[model samples]
Target chain A: MPNYPKGERRRAEILEAAFDAFGTVGYRNASMVQIAADCGVSRAGLLHHFPTKESLLEAVLKQRDRIDNEQFFAGGTSDDGLDYLTRMVRLVEHNAAHPGIVSLFAVLSSEASDPGHPAHVYFQERYARSRSWLRRAFRDLEQRGMLRPHVQPDGLDVEFLSLLDGLQVQWLLQPDAVDMPARVRAFLSRVLTEVA
Target chain B: MPNYPKGERRRAEILEAAFDAFGTVGYRNASMVQIAADCGVSRAGLLHHFPTKESLLEAVLKQRDRIDNEQFFAGGTSDDGLDYLTRMVRLVEHNAAHPGIVSLFAVLSSEASDPGHPAHVYFQERYARSRSWLRRAFRDLEQRGMLRPHVQPDGLDVEFLSLLDGLQVQWLLQPDAVDMPARVRAFLSRVLTEVA
Candidate 1:
């Protein structure tokens, strides 16, 4: 039999419910009651697990951060980051399949500017870490002679990270307009080509 | 002497104040009282120019949009967009100079997604129009054989538009780590190379 704790299973269920509720109604508009109802738990029981509405929101956000890192941000690519590009494109494709979570991040990322907001720190750290990690990956790629010779701005890492982020906003807003996978492939192919 | 009317000057002054207030405090946290103080007008006077908070907010957004479009969004290489790449680089540089307005858009674009929200329709149309403009521009480029022959998913316009939107989010979050203008320029250069 599976050894997962019953409480842990219930907590996961509550977080999933929160994700769905926030996806539909957004963070500010979604009620704790609806989330608890979705989980088939009493409001008090949900509170026992999350303590506060803000905590529940934070937990959901943390869950997404974990998944994003695991999927796109965790690994490195040697051959001009084509693998990373593919992973990122697939990540976007997955995000489109489960758009509720994407909406949650869109809503929370905007509101997270309030330093006291629960998600403020998470997003702040996320942007910082994502930029740094992607920078390192690009550096490793450049050192392997994948990038065109004498590219500036300390490497193409900053541009790559920005383009990755910028493409997500466009894809989320107008999926029909952009095939995220192809766009990444096109840019990487041009920039990451071996010196002939 | 400058021959502007009291009403015209007051309207202009209110917009200026609204820009500063909204830019600093964001759409939600900014107040009419603060806007009135900034313009040296009575709260009642401000309302006479703009009947409601929503009206004022919309007007402010419109003005900022106008400035951005005139200054940045209109960056086509020719009327047919030969200079679109260079023009977009200019836009990013301009945005970096006026981060206050950029921050306002970042906050409001997401807030404006509430169906009934003041800027909701504006953002919806804005995204559509921006993407459309880019697509048409790229279509022209493709027709003229300016872009690579095999560009797909409606060619470079869709991806170009997405990159601009996506880069803005990262630039807003991390100004130093991601040099917005430089990164955007590098990205444009890589994707738009005509190395024939």
Candidate 2:
């Protein structure tokens, strides 16, 4: 009734613009008016799609997660430990190719570390979900005797996640000095034998 | 010339206030006027000391680095690898107790990842210096055969720093769930046969 397809396309464009804005200057510093201008939409039109900056931020984060899932879990969440680690390497490789995506998460994740931040709960839940899945993968590795003798699965999930998150900042700051996929592979090999 | 000691005291107070503000709202969002107000200093007075926000940021970073060096290198930079690692653990323990300090770094280091950010060059040089020193430490360990058989010195410096930096975000987001020092110790123990 209201040109639904055109509306959807416009909405997608707004999301893309907001993602770049948020990634570049971060959410607090990013302006709605500027974002609207970036996407060639009026302020009212931008607000029509995203009622508030918070809503836009939410949409961008959701889009990011959706892309990550679609890319890595296309086969419906691999249960094999090796498959999971291999996918993680691919994900890091994918991230290296897209500095904007890495910058978005790196910026927002730290910015949202404040308890009062709008995305605080979002990041907390995201990390919890990541840790849970990683724990399952580590358990699978333990079952197959792939984890090294010194490798403890108890806090390994958080450590591994930290490694990935940490590597991103270094890679972003000094791209030539850090090879994200290589470092991730090195970490995985250190903890687990026969890393694929 | 005019109340030099008092001027120094006020500068210190301003630094403390800016550190807290920067940690809470990040550098881009932190307002100079608000920081001046927090320290009960007039805008002119604040400007008199720092001249610009960038200058204040530089001073705060220098203060942080000075504190770290004083606490860790009282003996003029330990040459022993075990002592260096032990000091690192102590540093992490110290950081866990100081959430504000950790927050300041976690927020700024990522925020400054943007090439145009004021502290961009500072963070780049800081990481370079850290990697160089860490590389030396690893080399010392390799020479003494303290590093495990599987441990490769190459890229280990960046990986270690990444683990530390990455762990800060998780710890800040969910402090109760993350034991920073413990996770650091675990990573160290995994790589080295004996961790002090």
Q: Which stretches of candidate 1 lie over 4 Å from their true place?
A: A1-10, A20-46, A69-82, A113-118, A148-155, A194-196, B1-47, B72-80, B113-118, B139-153, B194-196
Worst 10 residues of 1 chain A by lDDT: A149-158
Question: What TM-score does prediction 2 earn?
Answer: 0.96
The candidate scoring highest on TM-score is 2
Candidate 2 reaches a DockQ of 0.83
Scored against the true structure, residue A65 in model 1 reaches a CA lDDT of 76
TM-score of chain B of 1: 0.82
B20-83 per-residue lDDT for model 1 (tens digits) = 7665445666788889998899988998999888898889888988887798655333656556
DockQ of each: 0.34, 0.83
Give candidate 2's chain B TM-score: 0.95
